[model samples]
Target: MFTNDTPRQGLLGRFVAGLARTRQGLAGQIGRLFGANVPSAEDLEALEEALIAADFGPALAQQLMTPLHQRLSRRDLSNLDQVEAALKRGILDILSGVAPPPSTMDHQTRPQVLLFLGINGSGKTTTIGKLASRLITEGGRVVLAGADTFRAAAIEQLGLWGQRVGADVICHQAGADPSAVVFDAVQAACSRGASHLLIDTAGRLHTKRNLMEELKKIQRVVSRQMPDAPHERIMVLDATSGLNALVQARHFHEAVGLTGLILTKLDGTAKGGVVVAIADQLKLPITFVGLGEGVDDLQPFVPETFTDALFARS
Candidate 1:
């Protein structure tokens, strides 16, 4: 029901524009450091500090600085071009190494299931809506499963997205058992021959063991309905949360084995380097990035484009 007629010529441009804050905060410092002369030890120290402040985290910041330091010692990085190129290469290496595997769903898999998990305020709901829009535009039938029954507003939000995208939403009343909702939604998706089923789970912190157990129960129900159901368990992360996002990811990955990540609010945060941190530390592929509030702003993760955007001159 959604149309893919919009021009995509500006996707890269939008990606670049959305990263303005991050570039200004992180890359701008590097640019200033490399502007005039070969960087001194003091300059390298400053660069390391900048990287850390950008939320690359201490370990990754050091990992990135190591190669540059080696190049500096060997007198290989003499100019701004070499300096910028080296930094860019380092970032790309970290990101590409953990790139997510190709989607498991094919034409034969009538309903490829994706389960979304994250703490509240991580944009899980909005990510689902944008993903549904993308799937529908690609000529795929979608069924939204509002499994976040703990919150009535969560169900209403998903229903609105379903209506807007012309996808069916399977939901029970507020406070309904989430596992039951998932079971019913799985059955409905199979019966309706939907190509994709997106399940939105309750947004609870990883510290909440009871809620995590509920998530496992929902997974069990879905698996019972179809052995290979819930093909992807994705955790949505807020770009602004910095290292805390990594903590959330670690817990969720342990709880349900997260297959990928979706990072939202990139346009609003200067800590976009957290993406690199997440990839390097968690080894979780970032599947998509929410650049802005628009439905079309959710773009697939491309390491080259992202690194370029991050380092591109303002």
Candidate 2:
């Protein structure tokens, strides 16, 4: 169970701190350009350049500049505060459009299966561990399925997480068939009456057709046992990958149908603006963000908090 001392304020503070680099790169630049002076055309151009530099992508940068351009054309002289507010509104608009719907899992389905997808080194294993910890704290009986039999180390790593989180781990030997592993895991979960079954599959590059097909096969195996199984198919994205992350999301969503995204390594990267690009272009809701290395650092994504963090005063 989560400790009572884990205050809401603390989590929000962490969210802000994790976004420090991004805010510095984005809001810091804007602040220097518009501080105390009415932003001129050159200032606005520099602001747009900063947005693009922060990984907002060219398209989103243009959209964010639209209101500024309109205000400038109208000669609506505005203070730095007004410019900041306009920028915030623009970012919030993009994020809010792709806000996720409330999550609901049918209790009748027995073990609610959640399948995680991402390329290697995208932190899929760590995300699963963090999620398992959260679910267990919420009083749910959880089981982890190590379907990443391609890597013995992955199987071992998941086993360690299962032990740490006090959840059962269903795994097969290295080089074993991943689909077969899932087949057994579903049966185990059903028999044990687990509330949640978290499946960790082998990480493969999005460009690998065979690996993608393997993912589809695993999905098929799960559905055959429980028609509504694999209740959520979430793609874990490495935020530091910038535009490459967007490409990976697109391909994976096309291949296996992603229900949401979990962006990891947010704290270490300055290109956090990729969050906006991903939401605006793909329209995929970001469900959670990995803020730090701690087990509890993976918090549910809140657009308002994120926007506030990005534009936070120095």
Candidate 3:
């Protein structure tokens, strides 16, 4: 479990670096809009447009600006720093309101199941590999379950990650029943005394009905195999996809009740505000965020640094 233990100072630097694109754009907008003696209606409207353009979504963009609006109404913009501070505080509030409580189990329970869900190419497999590598480095035992039986390549890719990370990979022949793979994986994790079991589920979202049902089946199988398992149902999203990511989250959340979120490619998008939109709309905790291609780039989500990173100056 990341447990956001990457150290605050280090995490802040990583977040600032990962959010470079977003910080440049958002910070520039805030500075330019509020640089004047007092913010004009036009400036406020432009700020809203910038927030929406950053993929905060129209409603959240408006909702998040309430603090800034309050300052404007109260003629409290005398302290220029307060302008950006209010925006940061607003975003922080949205993120913090949905933050999940810290994991108390702390990998004490053997074979804690984690279900990875997303559409094809959402970096689900890669994220799993990175997570396994981290857990193993921290001296935790991990088992990778290639539950995506539809693709022979996915099974092979997960196997490679397992090998590289020195974790066990449980997979059936390509085109086998995914649920069967999940069941066997659970058994293997227990028998091997692994601390965590990461299951890579099918991502064929084009067939919504078939894919969702298969995922539900896998969830049911895992639940019966190990009680109170699938402890984490994490949906991986491409940050570049912005609001579209929310659509996928809604689908999976409604289908099997996602417990957390993982946004990938954070370093590649200027629209990181989508993070706030998803958290506010779904009310789910974001466990980890993929900042870059490196394994360590997949760091735990620290809300304070993440919010600060959005407006960090060069």
Candidate 4:
């Protein structure tokens, strides 16, 4: 996995490689517009269209371009470098508008609890495993709670990850009470002196009302034992879901007040700009981004790195 010790260029290269599809979509458009020209008003308009095409949403696309349009009219934007620089600046401003997530392992709160939420097929479980693997590799003990008891396969999947990562897993039989599993997981993590407790909750979106209330119940269960616990209510969203990913974040944030996001499936999606839309609209910071299937691919979300990779020529 990637750590702070990793070199900057190597890390940026990994991000660029992962965002190839997205770069091909958005950066491709920018490349077409900037060329050797000073970029006319019509050219800027076309770039705005490309932003929307990349799933930045119409409102944000316009918001991002309006300033460049003004600078262009005032003859401030001189060349291709200025155009790309202006766009990258606009993106970083929005992405860093919110504060970053707090430290993952707070010693005072031993067993820093993290709960993962998302709709089915959002790569929620896999993200948890990858994150837990990183935590353990960092010399932190992790106890995983398999609260997604709705599906037998989910419980089994979590167990497999637990074994693979050498973390203890607390799960119940399929269809068992999810809260009960959480209650036990909290106790296990506390007793074992674990540094973190990661819970994988059910993603049964079809049971809408029940699922939302169930998530709230899980929070309550964790709080009863360790107040201010469940320290991170992070949503694991699929970047490929596009606008629907934004919609999913809205629901989870409204229901249980999500603390941050971990976007997955960025490896093959051209709609990675949805990352911008989610952050711009919801004000939730993205914690991690899944670039590939390997555990090492889940890199900590770096706003500058992501923006550079997004705007890099494909």
How large is the C-alpha RMSD of every model relative to the true structure?
2.4, 2.4, 1.7, 1.8
Clashes of each: 0, 0, 0, 0
Cα deviation at 170, candidate 1, in Å, is 0.7
In the range 1-314, model 3's lDDT, one tens digit per residue, is 55666778998999999998877777667667655766665677788888988899999988877767777788876655666678778888889876665563265568889999999889999999999998898788999999998888999999998998888999999999999999999999999999999999888846799998998889899989887888889999999999999998998899899888999999999899899999899998888899998868898877888988887766
Model 4 spans > 4 angstroms off? 1-5, 99-107
Worst 10 residues of 4 by lDDT: 98-107
- Report the lDDT of model 4 for residue 202: 90
TM-score for all models, in order of appearance:
0.94, 0.94, 0.94, 0.95
Q: On residues 1-314, what C-alpha lDDT tens digit does candidate 4 reach at each position?
A: 22453467877898899888988887677677766678888888888888898899999999998998888888888887887788889899999875373353344688899999999888888988988898899888999999999889999999998999889999999999999999999999999999999999998847789899999999999999999888889999999989999998998888889988989989979998899998899998787889998878888888888898887765
What lDDT does model 2 reach? 0.86
User: Please, what is the whole-model Cα lDDT of each candidate in the order they appear?
Assistant: 0.85, 0.86, 0.86, 0.87
Q: How big is the positional error of residue 157 in model 2, measured in Å on the Cα after superposition?
A: 0.7
Best by TM-score: 4
Q: Native-vs-model 4 lDDT?
A: 0.87
Could you tell me the lDDT of residue 275 within candidate 3?
A: 94
Model 2: clashing residue pairs? none
TM-score, model 4 to reference: 0.95
Among all windows of ten consecutive residues in candidate 1, which has the lowest summed lDDT? 1-10
